[model samples]
Target: MAVPNAASHLDFVVDPEHPDAEPFYAPSKRNYPQAVKGFYRSIKWAALVATLATYYLLPFVRWNRGPGAPGQAVLLDLADRRFYFFFVEIWPQEAYYVAGLLVLAALVLFMMNALAGRVWCGYLCPQTVWTDLFFAVERRFEGDLHARRAREAKGWTFDRAWRLVAKHATWVLIAWWTGGAWVLYFSDAPTLVRALATLQAPAIAYVWIGILTFTTYALAGHMREQVCVYMCPWPRIQAALTDEWALNVTYRTDRGEPRLSLKKSHAARSRGEPAGDCVDCRQCVAVCPTGVDIRDGLQLGCIQCGLCIDACDAVMSKVGRPARLIAYDTDMNVARRAEGKPALRRLVRPRTILYAVAIAAVGSLMLWRLTTRPGGALAIAHDRNPLSVTLADGSIQNGYSALVINRDAAPRTFDLSASGVPGAKLVVEGAPSDGTRVRIQVPGDDTREVRVLLRAAAPSGAATSVPVTFTVVNETSGETATATDRFETPAAN
Candidate 1:
């Protein structure tokens, strides 16, 4: 919260010795965005409430996934290296899903960018929502931007001091809860909440909560627009991704230019001279979160949140002028209007089509894989150093490491057998081995790796390597999975 004192304001003095020298960066200034009410503001409020509610309350929703599995609807079971989302279970080996999800998210963001520039930053970003809430808290405690600015100019009094403290205290509380809710997704939410309340939760949980709390407070409460301006990369990305035709928060210079006072405009109009609607009021700049002046043409600072549009619309209403002088329109359209051409919108452009197609393809593929994947799986890796050994009975043996997965509600007994090798026999260490196959019992929703040895008499003569498939059959459900490896025979000298 680098709220510099008025006394600390710098004097820009030019040096006689190095006359061409200039400051590389300007000094940071405080931005006090005033509240505005209009269509866009209402939309922002709705989005804030909905996103915050989903973030804070989603962990409480429970889902029954049978015994021995967590009931939390969304959980990352680190101990078991499993991820549960309602009925969907993702094993550690299925981490590709996370990568696929990231790709899908990027495509969706691109689609949004194509539709409307930086709309995600304006409405749906966590930073914007939390910062909006924090601003509301500030306004509640310290009054709107005007009062706060006046109070600061007059120097801090006892009431102002208390208000500042109260505002920050509320911000910290909200941030703490934000962080606390995040940890609930890793474990049972209700149980964790009880543990946290009683100070019985793990130390790591408290550490994470504290870290997130501090960051949230610093970023949302203190930094605010600076995060979107100096820190975020989305603005730069949006700049590259956007075109002249992409819709953005723009000031219609044609409609609002020739800036004049209301009385001057009236006088000019009566004299049959040209006059513009704009009264040179700074309402649009006063309401922007990123402190961007949309009238200065498109800049990197604007998040396209449309608060400026709302502010301009409110100003237009008060002045009895038509609304939307500041609007979500394209720069190309603005130029077209300046050139006496009608504005045209083409939403279904090539870039947008590409993004939509990519999103749909990836989403459909993920859904199909999720729904059609097998319940059980197996894999085998054969030993290299000692590929085969000739026993006293002239039998050939090969060692292997076998991994079996059990995606079931209850424990299962799996019978392991080898095929594609004549007279081959399977033997699993530490498991019941019969003359035909080896039987191993595995717990539900788990994977086990075991040492296995296969012995089969020489087919006719010594063969170098022969393809063999190891099959594991679930005795209860009769579900089976197989993996292939080489069954080696001793080479002839």
Candidate 2:
């Protein structure tokens, strides 16, 4: 042995700057997930294709709403205060529907969580889908995990430099298109597309597109699993929500204990010694997008994508052992197997049943409300300051404001009438010269506010405040809407 160099003298003691002495929570290590091919991998690929197609194509779908209304099916017309989704149209006054929809979405997520842990994170989330797309592009240009790692070790060459350029350029294009698709939902898709191409679109649209493009490229392409691990709060919330019965990506430690290499396992079997089929392979870790080793037990880094199951299955097949050494199972089931007891599947437990019932109840209530909705709406506001006025003819007059909402698809006149005291005549200040009980025309899918004067013969001994009923009847459809307000009077002078 040769004598130690000057650098070796301080090696015996811990160095604060050394990696081994650093804290456990170090900066994220870049993950180059190896390509996997199996059942779970196939399912992920299908999900990626379906979700991306829907995002890129749904804005182009069209729906006709008679005349002077948006033709795009899912437009959010902020300028006109309307939200259109296929056959449904929501006005600003009906904002409760949006709250209902958000509640429904939350309940659906809870029900899904009760059945399986974080399935949304694995397959349906936008982050997961876009990240998968970026990964595919990277792999196509840079080869697989081993090749990428080797290339990194050898430093950048001419071929590597070109591949990096092509990969980042593709990512930018996809990000730009994602932003472009988002803006199409706010205006007529074809018209906006032409405007965007001709550089005539509004400055706000371009600004939003630029913001989204940068965020998408940074989050999905550069941040990758860091977003899932550190940025998102779902992983922490999910861990608390998950029950012992909920199926999750799990490794069967009972089958994997006493791990040995392939040769050692075969030798142990021949000698009738205990041996596991794990074979000490790191395929599960290699295929993990987040670089989590499932054998290390569940943690926040695990997205429950099931790629480890595919990797482990392939390894098992090569070793002539049973599959599912890593699969979707519960921790309780894993413990049961270790104890030589029958595994339990409690999918229909009390919590899950309660969640399912809540979902059904909310859905049914929303459906019933939608089916029985009125054709229009009405509101009345009595004058605040001059509550009552005494006319020269001993008649009591009440000034009021009336708003009529037309929910149908065609313009129509509404017959207005007021009743409470006898001989009460309703007069529209600027409407047609029809004496009392005049008709006012309201535009289709719009609200009209107008001033109204209510006159009635003064009763000698009436109460100070009188309740009045205002009704608007649709002339063409015979549909009616009503509102009630109180008219106030002072003591007789």
lDDT of 1 by residue, 318-352 (tens): 88999999899997899899999999998988998
Query: Measured by TM-score, how close is model 2 to the native structure?
Result: 0.86
Please write out the lDDT profile of model 2 over residues 153-220, one tens digit for every residue: 77869888999999999999999999999998888889999999999999989998999899999999
Provide the clashing-pair count of each candidate structure: 0, 0
Which runs in model 1 stand beyond 4 Å of their true positions?
1-27, 381-399, 417-425, 433-437, 454-470, 484-493
Estimate the TM-score of every prediction.
0.88, 0.86
lDDT of each: 0.87, 0.86
Q: lDDT at 129 for candidate 1? A: 97
Instruction: Give me the runs in candidate 2 sitting further than 4 Å from their true place.
Output: 1-26, 268-271, 379-401, 417-428, 432-438, 452-469, 483-493
Best by lDDT: 1
